[model samples]
Target: MAKDILHMTYENSLTFAQDLDRDDPLRHFRNKFHIPQLNDKDVIYFTGNSLGLQPKNTRVYIEEELEGWATLGVDGHFHSQKRPWFYYHKFSKEALAKIVGAKPSEVVSMNNLTVNLHLMMVSFYRPTSSRFKIMIEAGAFPSDQYAVESQIKFHGYNYEDALIEISPREGEYHLRTEDILSKIEENKDSLALVLFGGVQYYTGQLFDIGSITAAGHWAGAIVGFDLAHAAGNVPLNLHNDQVDFAAWCSYKYLNSGPGGVSGIFVHEKHGDAELPRFAGWWGHNESERFKMKKGFIPMSGADGWQLSNVNILSSAAHLAALEIYDEAGMEALRQKSIRLTGFMEYLLNGFNLGDDVLKIITPTDPAARGCQLSLLVSKNGKAIFEHLTRSGVVADWREPDVIRVAPVPLYNTFEDVYNFCEILKKVIF
Candidate 1:
């Protein structure tokens, strides 16, 4: 599917990419985001997988909340002219559900990414003495590694014994699907939970969520994902996949701002009162929320996972970004995303640098990756990254030796990819 749409011989010329940009369906969205400027020109920003470009309307959305606060004060909780603070998170629910392909009843917005991971762990990481292992990818984002380790330790188990780190085979960059499935089968006896990043932060590999979830259930284990880098960047089917739970930050692909509010999904099957969870007033039944409740009765569905009242300011920023997503639609952006990332891969693969000069560590199969491509530039990685930075290419530099570039579908264009490759070519020399 990716090849048929984007594997044509892409010419390495400024005009070639500009021509593609002219025909791009989502090109107009580029102007909607505030691209960073260098020397009065917009820098070729390509780090949407980290912090996304802020939407132009973010200020207006935030100001609306601020204005409500100023004009209504305590009354803003219910009397705001626009959306009241009492239900601010609700504005983002539909959009997030659409983005992740979940029912509105199964989604809610709150907290930050790792915090939600911890909270979800508190509820779902039920490890008995007989079955107390957790499986995670070897190169998961450091925060997830820390969270999983701590969760194991908190349960009075040693990390080394309770954690199962899955890695790529020798002489391989990405983990094979068969290898992962086989490992799950081998350790099904002791594996109680499978927690992995929906998209590996370092290698940009998109794990097979549906297959992995089915495998975990078949093996009598619960499966969940931390989707910090995947939520808005790729198509998801959380509800249909029958995932036990999932959490993700909005700062990256959701364009909500630094430390933007996080969200989570809990399958409807777990909404029963019997499932033990870490409870808070916000998770209480809304009708009795102000009653200063004696016994904790959680709201049904994912709303039962909320820890506190929504952050009005951050959620306003999220609402602003989600409006754009609602208008753009995930299906349309996904089609463009496959094309944009495919074009970047096409150019990266086309780079004729010798093996030692550089190599891409991300999977070539588009189905197994997102918009990011991690370049393992041998020896001079930091030097090359600095050069790209000086040349007005905004990207992320991972420690050791990798440069991560993501040409976001909302704002980035083929010309951005072309310009980035041009600078990279010069840097390599």
Candidate 2:
């Protein structure tokens, strides 16, 4: 199926996009989402990178918990018929594990993304006098930058000296794998942690996680990833890659509602190891949690990092979304994604827009990106973005100039991609 989609030819026309949609095995999945309407027509939603469209079952999922709360009261914690609120976090584990390529024991659904990142760092970022520096991609999402910097400061080190941000070469939009490895080698001794976004939010570039993790490990540094943009948008093998740890939010490609519960992965190798972490009752060994003991006997695996009990309502929504993923399968979704985004790129390149007016900062190679394409609009950038908004195209605009658009495979169709480019072309011309 993947090979067939990869080798298929594309044309610049509405009929072609429609035909592809007609044959798309996942096409019916679109109806499962609540696509925003504009004058009774579905808006071209390309901001799945920022916020995923709501799953139609999201309300049903949340309502079940609400109903359980009303009737069961406090007893719902242990007695809810469908899903016991006490073990709510465990409900999504199997599905999430499949999405990220990990054993259920190595992954857990818990706090928000940043909070989980800090928690992971607390355990993984054990900076020593000689090995105190951390490495990250330059121009990473602001929250990641702040988190890494704060961790450095918390360790009594200045970010300027202790943070090593790897930037792309002049005139290049993405980092070369060789450059990343060389940078790690050069600073092997002082590097304490090698952290990076699995897929860069700005440029839509998917880093070589396995290679990076191997390099970081070889350099005697702990390796991790902020998979906010990579989690469900692309295929991942976190467990096999031997990634020390990873954390990602569900609000993006995972289709969980806003501020949805985040997920964490701890390689089985360190799952039971004693590590520095902020603990709470939820993370304590379940068998003895009610004993109210002073000692923190953490539950094994990623659950040990939990700081609090799961938020029932939000997690219900998360589980609702994960159900869809489990049925669709990540491998199938990835194959469709490659074809969908490749078609988008093929159409965009057809515009032959001058470099002065617009530039696609995202890598052209399908292997290096997910569904998003970041356009660097040099002239009238904001005006162009506004025009897209007025035309009902939901895309994200980053700082002084880039526009990010994602043709999410689960719901967004090839026709949506073609229409978006058509809308973009009108404003440019």
Candidate 3:
């Protein structure tokens, strides 16, 4: 059945992608990635929200570093490759800054997700007598809750007092900006920081970041975001929005490979703020770093937040991915994403699969979301998920019930979504 579907010369299948690709300014980018092959067929890959498909150039990028290590030995730190190991992270800084709408000086690619979150919290989660509460979405990613809880304990405050959760109203799948703002206003005197995921990992809701930051500031609290599911998935103007800080992993939407190095952003306004942070040798002034100085004189910008030297291998993958992003600019990619995802919604509704079978939990408005859609299965969610996997429809499932299907604009086509919907109808009915 899967074979026949793939072989089917349906006009909708070819015409949809052909029409979009014909006018698609970013259509050529599909060739840059290595889509997975299964049984001589290109598997329908709709899991970029969980893990992105690797870029073909990633191998060449890694090979260059390997050859440099073999030839230059220690000297590879300063020579032997297109980008030196010593300054490899710098290769992608400008591109990353543009992706996140930050200044080059305000962004640095470094450690993985949770590690960077802890580091940012150390400096930002300062709890005093009266104002020490931290506000976050109730359904935040599990790791985020753990980090926030641990930070509160480190400050000798009970979690109950230090943590404020903004949850959706009863029986609702998404949160409202008005509700979040109201919570900040209600607890203005006690709120210390407003920290949230720029896009909720489970619900696929893109929070109103700029408005959230303004609300936090009005209440005399700092603002930050965990961009793990947001960066590369959406257009984030971090610098222009004046967010105090943000951190995101490159593995998922960024397509840097699983468990890849993450990036951090600090607004230029706080570049010289008198905030106490945990420091280490790598953050020392570059000019005097090798001198083995006595005290840690941190660099002035986001690089100062680094606690150790960059991990060359992991950073190399990120650099490879960023090159692809640069070639196919974000604005162009986002334009395709809207059309592709809108088509997914259209097809799902076209199925006319009774409401008792499947329901979409993600927000309907395009402005409130990204490429991913969270489908709430009415029954046998796990079984259906396994069935989809067996059928070569690659998606991810959350606990209890919810299947996430993300059609990444960079490598996915409208035909993929069209075929996925056809399979779903057959399986459900």
Candidate 4:
């Protein structure tokens, strides 16, 4: 697509992204998605950390369910051999469990991301007047901040007194792990819960979930994560890490459609039906769900946390995306992610346009970040972002002055990274 192809794959070669793509075992997975095209050519898509590309099979999968709904209507809930709407959430259970490293019993596919977060907090954020503070990253996604604030206000506590927000140090873009642990210790006396994104959305910093969970427990506070940016993009062991609860959206790296059904993980220890959840029929025991009992007899594990029936259409889309994940597997995907993102980092560092061009604010250690690299642009940041978009690169531009590009492993090639860098260099100069 470049007029000067040499600069694209030659002058821009280092990690020799082309060779890396040739060697990638997961290279074939790229063919599974529908890459966005402009002027009869695919865009250099780097926005999987924001919204993933649609799978080619996604429509086929969705059509099956649509046909069932068209023919069977009400009967599709129980009689559809393809996938019963009655037990729709079951289809995603195993795949989601594998993605997040939890037992099948601990996961459920339901509602949207923010809805699941609020649902999870209802049972987990039990605050007493004595130990009432909740800890979170200072600049969390607006939905999370709003949820926490509303939940606190609902409990008759003021935000200033009840919310403990951890911020990055001066001249820094991400919070230090040691600082997070220290704050957990300092707030332990009055902290009721500790919650944060598994990966910081704007900064692309991957928090240490295991360490944070341990510290939160030691502090006598329950710990949870919002995995909007981390799920399916990184490897997680939610169960082994002893994270009390978590919720994630399927729209991003999970590649489910817009507003796709979300997933929740409640450690098996919280499996008791009497754990004070806001429940509904879909979360009732399978045999008794239709009994229409006077009281809610919750299903075991995470399903017990569901508040309503499965959002069937959205869940169907989720099932479609998860099938791909189940096939590629998170382990293989994560290995590719490290290299793909690393390739982007290598090219960014070598761009040589000087710091005035831009500086990556995302963590340097691959382990401390997901696929996203947040570039803090010091000059003409928005204009450069517009130029990249015009050049057929799909990335995110966060307000003020930051651009986040995630070279997704599932479909992005090393060649894509090379072209992106070449175009970026030309634009900056």
Each model's lDDT comes to 0.90, 0.93, 0.87, 0.88
Q: Write the per-residue lDDT of candidate 4 for residues 308-427, one digit (tens) a residue.
A: 887777777788888889999887887777777777777788866676668999998878988899999999999999999999999999999999999898999989988998899899
Report lDDT (Cα) of residue 115, candidate 4: 86
TM-score of each: 0.98, 0.98, 0.95, 0.96
Stretch of 10 with least lDDT, candidate 4? 1-10
- Model 2 TM-score, 2 decimals: 0.98
lDDT of 2: 0.93
lDDT of 1 at 236: 97
* Runs in model 3 lying further than 4 Å from the true structure: 1-14
The lDDT of model 3 is 0.87
Total backbone collisions, model 2: 0
Instruction: Provide the lDDT at 240 for model 3.
Output: 88
In terms of TM-score, which candidate is strongest? 2
Query: In model 4, how large is the Cα lDDT of residue 301?
Result: 91
Assess the local accuracy of residue 289 in candidate 4 as a C-alpha lDDT between 0 and 100: 77
Model 2, 1-429: lDDT tens digits are: 356666768899999999999989999999999999887888999999999999999999999999999999999999999999888878998998888889999999999999999999999999999999999999999768999999999999988999999999999999999999999999999999999999999999999999999999999999999999999999999999999999999999999999999999999999999888999899999889889879999899998988888899999999999999998998878888988998988898899987788888998878899999999999999999999999999999997999999999999999999999999999999
Runs of candidate 1 with Cα error greater than 4 angstroms are: 1-3, 6-9
lDDT of 1 by residue, 245-308 (tens): 9999999999999999999999888865467788999998999999995999989988988879
